[model samples]
Target chain A: MNVMIEATKLTKVYQMGDEQVHALRGVSFAVQKKDFIAIMGPSGSGKSTMLHIIGCLDRPTAGELFIEGLNVQEAGGNKLAEIRNQKIGFVFQNFNLMAKATAVENVELPLIYAGIRKRERRQRALAALERVGLSDRIKHRPPELSGGQRQRVAIARAMVTEPAFILADEPTGALDTTTSGQILDLFAELNDEGNTVILITHDPTVAQRTHRIIELLDGRITRDSSRNGVGA
Target chain B: MNILETMRSALWSLQSNKLRSFLSMLGIIIGVAAVVGIVSVGLGAQSSVLDMVSALGSNLIMISPASTVARGGSVSGDAVDLFTVDLANHMQETVHNMSLVVPQVQGSGLLIYEGANLRATLVGTTPSYPEVTNYHVQTGRFLHELDVENATPVVILGSRIAENLFGQANPIGRELTYVVGDRRHSLTIIGVMESKGQVLMGNYDSQVYVPISYAMERILRTQTVSTLMAQAISAEAASTAVGDAEFLLYSRLGTTDGFNVTSQDEMLETMGDVAFTLQLMLAAIGGISLVVGGIGVMNIMLVSVSERTREIGTRKALGAKRRDLLMQFIVESLALSTSGGAIGMILGVLIAKAVSDFGGWATSIEGPALAIAFTFSALVGLVAGVYPAMQAAKLDPVLALSHE
Candidate 1:
């Protein structure tokens, strides 16, 4: 199995006023290539912290994190940013699209940061939007699109960089049940196309569709399950 | 991200808030406009003044009687008669580098030609007046040395005086009556000088010139000359000529308090210094407004940073480096100020043109001034954008993404 992300004994402590809050306490996990996994937990369960650590958005207070065989804990800020740019794709619950930019422009954002040339960036963005079934709405701004369509545009933006893994935080949390199903179908399709997908959600119905599940409670993993007993 | 990408993003963001961007740019616009306009007009005035000084004859020097009262001496008639044609001649013979020497006396008189009466400034000077004062005869001939020795009733009319008195007719060879206090002397117009335009001293085209001997012996009946005008052989020799004249005058008069000698170059230098100081003071005042405009830019950038905190976080999460965010905001502010500077430069040129057209002032728009002002506005933008950009760059991504 090719491990795309591996977090070992990760702990994160944040200072709140004069008190210390442990957001994560000695959590360990690994995500394999092309694996569709859902991290499930209720609020304050440190699921978000786990997602952040996996996305390379925040450093752990004590742990070793490896992204594609590169130790993220030893990476500098800029190096970590490069890792995020080249390896991890992030999808927020709110879509996080620039409201003023068209769908294609938003899709091209990561490629711009990746220092790709303009013509190639546009070509790849169009391909990504086509992949997300947003080819017809490529010129539309986020505000002009429906919630599901907006999430599709966000997905296009995420996958446009051809990153190793797509890290989605509550991808369908803000959508209606019908729209949520369609977005989940798109994610499954993307995962089937050989892109690793990590979905963070509190809803079991949302987690049940994935191939594997990692459940957290009070900053510790309680269950790690695989539908096909490959590496569970 | 590359600079071009950053600039595009910055421009897109600014376009989303058009009114706010323009309002923020207004301060810089006014500041740069004021600076460009004031400096250009001030330079015009300085150049005009310098032109008038140069028109006075670059190689010329003047010797005049100093006020005896300034030396704590009682008024004496002998002191008023100290400067004479004999002393002028003696200085001409003794001073090195002397080219031409002309003594002059000045008064106001009424002229009558064919019932057209006008008051004109009368300059009683020797034949060398044309060479010493740079006056050229446009018609006929200038005053001859014979006219001075014989005290003949011959006079040269200025362009404006000739036009006023004789209309379209030639004034040369025409007789005109000059009225002094209780005396009316008829003089023949020997020449008409070309127009020399208005100068600091007065209108050169509105004066009449006569032989020094004629005015002293016949009209004013005064033996004293008001000033002794001398030309140096070259502009570079003017200082030497001044020193030699002053030495000769002091030796003959037995004291330095009675007369003052000044070269045209010295007067030009003093006036140039005064003009430079005035320009500096004006530019400083304009600079204050630029600083205020920079502060305004800083204030708006801070607001922009706060307003776009979530956007910054999103870009960071999408792999924008700290340097990228910094460049974006800095480029936005620079775009704002540089555009304002460009508009201000055009406005300043328009202002100078308006002044030259309507205010009757000579105004010039200097290229270097525009370049400097534009560069300064850009510098102001850079300085103003630093703190806000640093703040944006230092934002904690998680906290910023969660910000409302």
Candidate 2:
């Protein structure tokens, strides 16, 4: 297995007036290529902070993180932005798709940041949307779509650039049971297609669907288990 | 980001709020219009004054007699001796820079020719009067030195007076009778003068001219000359001519200085100075209007920033630089002001032309003023855009991204 993400002694502390809130505390983790991993935690744990660090959306206060053999903290603003644009994709809990743009335009944003021409970006975005079973909603805005369909559009946006890792921070947190089930199936399908998927959630049932689960409590990982070939 | 893309985005954004954009540009429009209109008025007045000054002969000087201290009795040689025929003769002979001199006395009477009658001013002048002033005969012949030598019953009618008495027919060789101070005398019209338009005082072509000796003997019945007219060799030598004339008069008349001599250049300089000060005052007034317009732009841009906060957040998340955001707002402001300036310039020019055509005044639009107005409006836009751009640039993506 190729190690896609490697972090050592990752710690983050935020100041709240005279008090300090420790978001992460010297947590170490490694993720391999094509791995479907779930970070399970109770409320106020460091799961989201760890996920943010892995996605390079933030810098660690007292640790070093390497994504695909590049030191993220040493990277400059343009370099960090390039890594975020070309190597990582994000899916927020609330389906953070730009509501003003149509479904295809929302998917085409990463490609635009990559400086792709308009025609090619549209073609590639349409194909990505089709792969996510959203071909008929190409011209519809998010306000005109259902919750599951909007989540599919967000997934399409995350996969449009063919990034190495997809960071799903509570991807199904806002969906109902049926919609969450469909989204979990979509994640399984995406993971089977040789892409690394990191799902951050607090639900045990959601964690059980992945190949491996890491449970976090009080800003530390207490249990790590692999359910290899069990769901298969 | 490229300038073209930013400009396109700004234009598209502004198009989304047509009424707001128009309202923001209104300040710049009024400011530019005020600047252009005021400058046009000032320029028209300056040019009109220049025309009037040039119409008078450049080298001419006028001298008026002194006022007597006592009205009951006149002193021997000190009183009533400032202007005289002897003084005029002495100045002409002794003043080296002088070209010609004429003594004039004036009165008003009715002019009668055939059956037509018109009220007119009667002026008594020497044969050299036309040469001393700018007036000259345009038709027939002027009253020559021989005419004045013989006290000939000859007169030169102004163009307007000729037109009033002779209706299109030549007034030359016609007889015009003037009743001056109870004496009625018939004089032959020898010449018609060219038209000299009006000035600050009055029209120069409304008076009637006759030989000085004839007028003094036949009309006023006084030997004291009313005024002395002096002409210099050139415009630059007017002061020298005046000094020489004064010296000669003082030496011949044996009197101290009690007379006043005025030159066309002196009067023009004073008028130009006053005009320049007025232009400065008007420009300051226009600048105040522009400042008020700038405040309007600033206020509108602040509103735009507040309204577009979410949009700015999205752009920042998309990796737009601070300069990119600044450029968009700045371009919006410049577009507003430049468009307003263009409309204002056109309106100002049209207004100037309309005034000139309707009021029969010489009104012109100055090129430098138009350029200045445009530049000033652009500056105002830039100043107005600064606060808004700073506010837009400082928006934090974390908070803005989650903004509802």
Candidate 3:
């Protein structure tokens, strides 16, 4: 199906020391193949909560989440894990590469869980790094790399599994303005290569780069807009 | 996904916290070392004990009157029945695995020659005593059957007793005076026993031998023998010989009163039992330390999990199963404990060897004890790692990612 991730009236309630915090309230959306989308919101806007459900990291309290035509809420913990392994690729803003692993080793993480053999995982990780234009920096750790290079390494890791959708959670949150721009450009380039890219961020500048932006405010979607031409 | 990659990842994590990991493993190290070392020491004690017991002879069975504590203890039957005279005949007729049986009556006397005076234990027995008890005559000749029948006034002195009396003078055919109760009698030294060596029991070189008839009728003035030493044809038949002797004694006396049969094997077994009990106690003590060490691993693992919240989140995002996270942490803990146990075993062996070489306490580490100690340590690790690993696995991927 072209509809890679479809959510319907998703609700999430979290207990925080005798108080109920409504993280998400009946949020509904769908992401299609090759579609570049942004869920843009400030802190406490439930954007992260939404990404967690779509990434199969959390199940909805009162809704249905269909990832790759499979309902995640009905899936067991192990099945959800398998679905996440097979279908999701998350790129975090911190460039969450393992601190001790080299760029190539960081990229190999997903395949390692996917039960890919070592030699092929190495080959695929090398190809993924090459795709991110990090062929020369594949042996460097995240601590040794510049912000933009680290983001590229994270992107390489996200793309290593060749998943249908790329979930970018505040992909430029930890970078300088110039490095953020470079990372945004890399996202647009990856989209140009026909990977569905979901950018979760608060910055208008980042949302302007996606073809569609679903803006949320206090656990509910306030705006859903589509600007079909690729870059801002 | 696979064990190799999991272990590699675990290895990497442990390597990152080398000092902390090593410190955490110290408990296991000490625990395993103590267990292995104590076990070796116990086994060594057992061996030394076996040496002391078997020095009397391995295939030899000693029949005494209950109360004398040997290396081990009696096997099954009760005690005490005079198998004295007809004992040898019954044994030869019934037990086919017999070799020799020497009845012994013990007495003590003061010996004097020139300016030297020595207190000596006198053993009265037949000519078969040396063969059954592994003693040999170094010089002159042993007493014969004719000497026992004739109540010969000849005596065979132990090496030390002969040396004390004779100095550089030849003791053979020399006149020696022995005082019994207040009466003194003169006897001729026919032979001197070879130096068998000294033990905790007594020095064999200080004993003097006389024929049973000569000792009981003249010196001891009694007919009751103190103990009997019997030799089986082979080591395998030693137990059978004890059993046969016990059966014959039971059938003859209808009770075990006045007779106790002890085998070298039984005595060795008792020593072995003592070693086993000691090892068990050591293991329990060691296990407590290992448990404490396991707790140390758990404590460190908990800190690691809390510290690596974002890392856990990233792995979950990259599709790590609960079992994967569980496996990773478990493997890390297991690696810590096993490595610690190995180092501890080496240290324990070294300590044991040092004690054996320099401290005079024998220590021996067998392969089985080492294996058991190591496996127990690893099991401790596994148990200790569970809660921490489960805690890490249960972390919320979104919240963990948000953690600094």
Best by DockQ: 1
lDDT value, residue B286 of candidate 1: 78
Model 2, span B1-404: residue lDDT tens: 56765676667667767898888777777778878877887889887897787677758777766664644575643535556677777777877787877788887899888788888887888878877777898898777878767778898998899888887998888888998657799999999999987754456678888887788787777777888888888878899987876666567556655666777787788788888899879878878888898888889888888877766654554445567778889888777777777887887777767778887767769899999999999898888988898888777644555567
lDDT of 3: 0.86
**Model 3, B269-321: lDDT tens per residue?**
87778877876887788788878888888898899999998999889889898
Query: TM-score of the candidate numbered 3?
Result: 0.81
- Over B1-404, each residue of candidate 1 has an lDDT whose tens digit, in order, gives 89999999888988988999888888888888988998899999999998998888659898888766633575544435778999888878877688888899988989998768999999898888888888789998888989998989999999999988787887778898999988999999999998998866788899999988998888888889888889999988999998898887777667777788889888889889999899889888877888898899899999999998888888988999999989998999998888878888888888888998999998878999999888989999999998999999999888887788
Cα lDDT of candidate 2 equals 0.80
Task: Tell me each candidate's TM-score.
Answer: 0.94, 0.76, 0.81
Kindly indicate the candidate among 1 and 3 with the higher TM-score. Answer: 1
Misplaced by over 4 Å in model 2 are A1-12, A24-60, A65-70, A75-232, B58-88, B102-124, B132-134, B146-155, B164-166, B173-188, B199-201, B212-229, B235-269
Two-chain DockQ for each candidate model: 0.75, 0.21, 0.64
Give the whole-model CA lDDT for all candidates, comma-separated. Answer: 0.89, 0.80, 0.86
Q: Report the error of model 1 at residue A84, Å.
A: 1.2
lDDT of 3 at B100: 83
Q: What TM-score does model 3 score on chain A?
A: 0.95
